[model samples]
Target chain A: MRSHARIGFVLLLTPLVLWLGLLIVIPHIDMLLISLRERISFGVYETSTAQYQKALTEPLYLRTFWRTAVMSVLATGITLLIAFPVAYYIAKMAKGRLQQVLFMFCLIPFYVSELVRTFGWMILLRETGIVSNLLQWTGLADQPVEMLYNDAAMMVGLVYTSMLFMVVPLVTTLESLDDSVIEAGYDLGGGGFSVLREIIIPHAMPGIVSGCIVVFMLSLGNYLTPTMLGGKDSLWFTEMIYNQFIVRSNWELGAAFGFMLLVLSSVIVWGMLRLTGRTLQETMG
Target chain B: MIPTIPQSRSFRLVYGGYVLLFFLYLALPLTVVAVFAFNDSQFPSLPWQGFTWNWFFGDSDPQIGVFHERGILRAVGTSAIVAGCVAMLSVAVGMTNAFLFNRYEFRGKGALYVLMLLPLVIPGIVLGISILIASSTLANGVWDVAQLDIQALRPGLLLVVLGQFSFITTIATLVITARLQKFDRTLEDAALNLGATRLTAVRTITIPFLMPAMIGAVVVAFLMSFENFNTTLMLVGSDAPLTIAMFDRLKEGSTPLLNAVSLLLMLGSSLLALLVILFQRR
Candidate 1:
């Protein structure tokens, strides 16, 4: 029986070991190693940090990376601000059936793919699209204003894409909080803003941090939304990586840029977890 | 925020209005996508010409509907096959991971568990490129050493399956493990004590209990694989999945046929989502 259990353990462990080793762990390590080497000649590589060096020295690369990071953070912040009240209403304020329906509304759009969602945004924001037409009809503008291809459009798409990620976590955390506590705060002469700040925010911090981390990572890594919405000036760092790998065939530099994205995003996420007193296990789980 | 506490009328109005607007923001885009599927115009945008089904059924030169569009139909077939393969593989491996985590005491379990979740944090594009590099390098090495070619280790549908299966399995395992954690050990113990072998007991008792979550995982995995773009875009070769095909077309330009495609995708996925939700309710 003992050996049988041991054999079963090995059987289960085999696929997992193979999956993680071949697909997840080793590939990332290979990418790191590839990023460290420079193509000295055709197919002859020497180990160097020139790829990373180029990432740092090139103004285009540096600025794009900075913009992606900053935009992602901003998007996360905006998602939280928008999603918080909705989540608060669903979790704390709404009744049983209404709560479920409202939450379902939040989830239905996400069931469709991100590509479809971005396509929908394009249809709405393009020069000949609905929003422009609505603006003209409402007498707000005379011309069909081209709204597609701007930072603001990119931000709207980012926030819209990530809003549910924020709201889901916020709703989950907020639902577990006892309503009596909020009532107690109000009964103790706390104003609405004060109660929300002192009671609700503290209680919802775990969800807040987790949601922000996921949203920020998503926005940072987002390819379709930024590229589709923000035309010429998108300047997404992932585009740089894509250009390196697919367009220019510079795999080494692409690997370096990929590592920079991974490391920078991870560091910021770690910093967030530490500051918020949450473990990764807690957040992700 | 407390329901029991009465708020001012202005506050109530504002909160109610915000919720209303939030749902509108969520619904408007997809609604427009669906509604325009029936529009008579060639473009997917506004100025909706009177209603028509040309985008869904038209087969003419300029008005080719999604059903008649060969590229899109083939891509949809490719996506379905990929999603099916990914769903099966992810669930099988995910079940193994669930049992491994739930049924045994092991060394370095905590660390391995965290490692399992690491793919979720790694960006999809990074995961895609890393896999591409790793596979091609391995293929090249094998070719150099043994003059052998391995097709699986290349940028293609197989790579897309592997890439999606990587992170998706994490989700599957999490779902199955959540179900497993709640299993009553006594039922399996009762079966064992009642003259049943361990395999029989597990096959009949434990597996049936986990079937719902396993089904849910399958649906979730399939939907995720179908909708996946970032990883698939990086790894796709000659055969593009539906999302990739749609993306390529969008880059060049779009017609109302794409909106028709979106409408079909929406309905198909919503049906799948309903399945999972209904199963969960059970």
Candidate 2:
């Protein structure tokens, strides 16, 4: 009977294993191999270390890497700031149907595509857009403001896109916390601020760290939002990779950039795990 | 336990203001796009001339540029077909994988489960570019052997579906696996103990229990495929999906047509989500 069950399991996993091997593992191995190769004229790749050397030495690549890192960190921080209070309120204050309704409102944006949401921001932030028009009407500025294409716009897009990811985990973690812990903190002569700092934050640390990891990883890899909102001036690292492969047709250089991004993010994930003592799988749930 | 509610008016004002601002930030962009979908203006921006339906169901008029483009409609059709195929393939594969992982444990099970999740961790851009290269290489090699031209072996629909299936299946598998973990094992055993064949037990007991999760997985898979941009952008050949078409149009300076499309897509997805919610409730 045990053997039969094992056979059934193996039979079931056969397709998935084969599919992953062909579509994921093998292709990744190929990407690694291509990264070590040298790119010749007309976008062809030859095996060499020249591309890797170029990627490491180039100031453009290094600058873009640092810029993306800073942007991702800022975005993650901002999202956490905005999401924490709302998540706390929903998990601790609201009850029953009201909580569900509020949560649904928070999740409404997720139902729409990211592209559509970003386009909406584009319209609102444009020089002659609604936001600018409102500012002008209120006599806050002499002329319509140009807030559409900049780092600010990119940050706004990233934070807005990642807020749900931040909120959901936080609410889940906060909801599971023992209410008596907070009550005990208060009974022990702790004020609201002290209770939050001492009891709530520490208990919710896993969720906060998980949310930060998700937002950072997403922002680091993001190409669309920065490209659309930040316009031509935005030298995001992923955009550089896109240019190398798509525009410049340099496959080896693109592969090197891709590999670097993979390694950089892997390190970030590792550091996060080390700091929080939580794996990616735990955070995902 | 409910904490002490803030009774001060100033506290209410501050908290309410923050909530209002957050909602406005979230909803304002979508509202702008939706409103512009009704605008009669040539451009997507403000200064709306009047409300108009010319963009959506209008006669071909090159002068006003009010007509629906045939190209975009074709792209939408292509997107629907591709998304449908991807949803079906991913759900089927994911259900099988989830059942395997949840119901039984065997040697190498842990390794296989981790391997299944590998695609989800990798960024979409990396996946897209790698799949594009691999498929192109395979197609080229096969063409050389078969004495056929590269054009003869179309890498469009098949490759796109295959690429999307790689990760989308992982997502579906995870969802279904979660649901399966909550499944009652005694039901299946009871059916088998009642002299039912093993296949019958699975078909009658296990499948019915999994049906809701299977449906949810399908719906989620469809949405993921429909909104997929990165992988589709790389793998797509001559035909464009809706997202790619919109990207191309935006690059050339957008119009109300893009807003119209967004509104339509938003409505469709919300309605589908509503349907799924209704089904789950039932």
Candidate 3:
């Protein structure tokens, strides 16, 4: 019977293993190999270290890399600030039907494709957009403001796109908190604010940390929002990688850019694990 | 129970206001897109030029009109077919993996599971380009060995399906695995003890229990495939999926026709979700 079960397990795992091996593991190895190659003029590649040297020393690449890092951090911070209160209210205050409705509302944006959602932002933030028109009408500006095509718009798109991921985990952790714990803190003559500081926030730290990691990873890797919203001048790190392969036909530089991003994110993931005192698997799973 | 201090009415009002505003913020963009679907104007933003169905039904040089435009309709059909095949293939693969991982302990199960999740963590662009290169290389190598000429390996529906299935199956496997963990082995054992073959027991008892999760997995797989852009963008050859088509159109500039398409897609997905809920309730 044990032998039979082993056979069944192997049968089940074979396809998935093969699929990942061919599609993921092999491709990743290929990417690393290609990154080590030098791009020849005819849009072909040859083996060399020149591409890596250029990628490492280039000021353009370095600036974009740091800029993307800063933007991702800022976006993650802003998402946490907005998501926490909404999550707190949903988990601690809302009840029954209201909670379900509010949670559903949080999830509704997820139904729309990210492309459409970003496009919607484009419409709203454009010079002739309602936002600008409102500002103009209120005499807050002499002319319609150009909110689109900048870092601020990019952050808005990223935060809005990733808000649900932040909310869900935060709510899940907060909801598991025992009401009696808060009651006990209050009974000990702690004020609401003090109780939150001493009990609630610490207890909810795991969720906060996990949520931040998720948002940060997503924001760091995201290429679409920054491209569409940030426009020509953005030059985000991912866009740099994209240009290397798609526009410049330089696979090695693109691979270097990709590898740098992978390393950066891995470091962040490692830092988060250390800070939260949980393994990556524990935080994600 | 000790009575809690009643909060001031204003507190409730403030909290309620915040929730309401947040909800509105969430709904605003979608609401704008949906409303603009009915506009007579070409652009999505409006001073209403009166309601018109021409965007949906009109045929012109620039506007294909509604879901009826040849390109839009064709893209939708391609998307649906691709999404359907992807759902079926992923669920089949995922179910097998879930059953295997859940039912038996293997030496390298941990490593295999981690490997499966790599596609999810990697940036979509990276995955897209990697898959394109790997597949094209393999195809080229095969063609070279066979002494046959094949021009390209990356562009086509088959490649798109292959690209999508790579990540989507992992998702399905995760979902089904979660469900499988909760399954009672005793029921299967009881069926086997009652003289059913293992396959028979699995078919009659295990599969029946897993049906709802399988259906949910299918729905999720379909939705993911439908909305997939980054990977599809890189892998797609000639034919464009709705999302890609929309992106192309957006590059040229915005149109109310895209809004119409968005509205229709929203309705289609919601209706499907409602149907799933109803079926589950029954």
Number of the top candidate by lDDT?
A: 1
Candidate 3 ranges beyond 4 A from true positions: A40-46, B1-12, B60-63, B143-146
Error of 3 at A255 (Å): 2.3
lDDT-best of 1 and 2: 1
Q: Compose the digit string of candidate 3's lDDT tens values, residues A100-190.
A: 8888788778777888788788878888776887888799998878898998889889999889989999999989988888889888998
Error of 1 at B6 (Å): 1.1
Q: Against the hidden reference, what TM-scores do the models get?
A: 0.99, 0.95, 0.94
What would the DockQ be for model 2? 0.60
lDDT value, residue B256 of candidate 3: 86
Model 3 residue B142 distance off true place after TM-score fit, in angstroms: 3.6
Rank the models by TM-score, top first.
1, 2, 3
Q: List ranges where model 1 is wrong by over 4 Å.
A: none
Question: What are the candidates' individual DockQ scores?
Answer: 0.83, 0.60, 0.50
List per-prediction Cα lDDT, in the order shown: 0.92, 0.81, 0.82
Residue A262 CA displacement from its true place in model 3, Å: 2.3
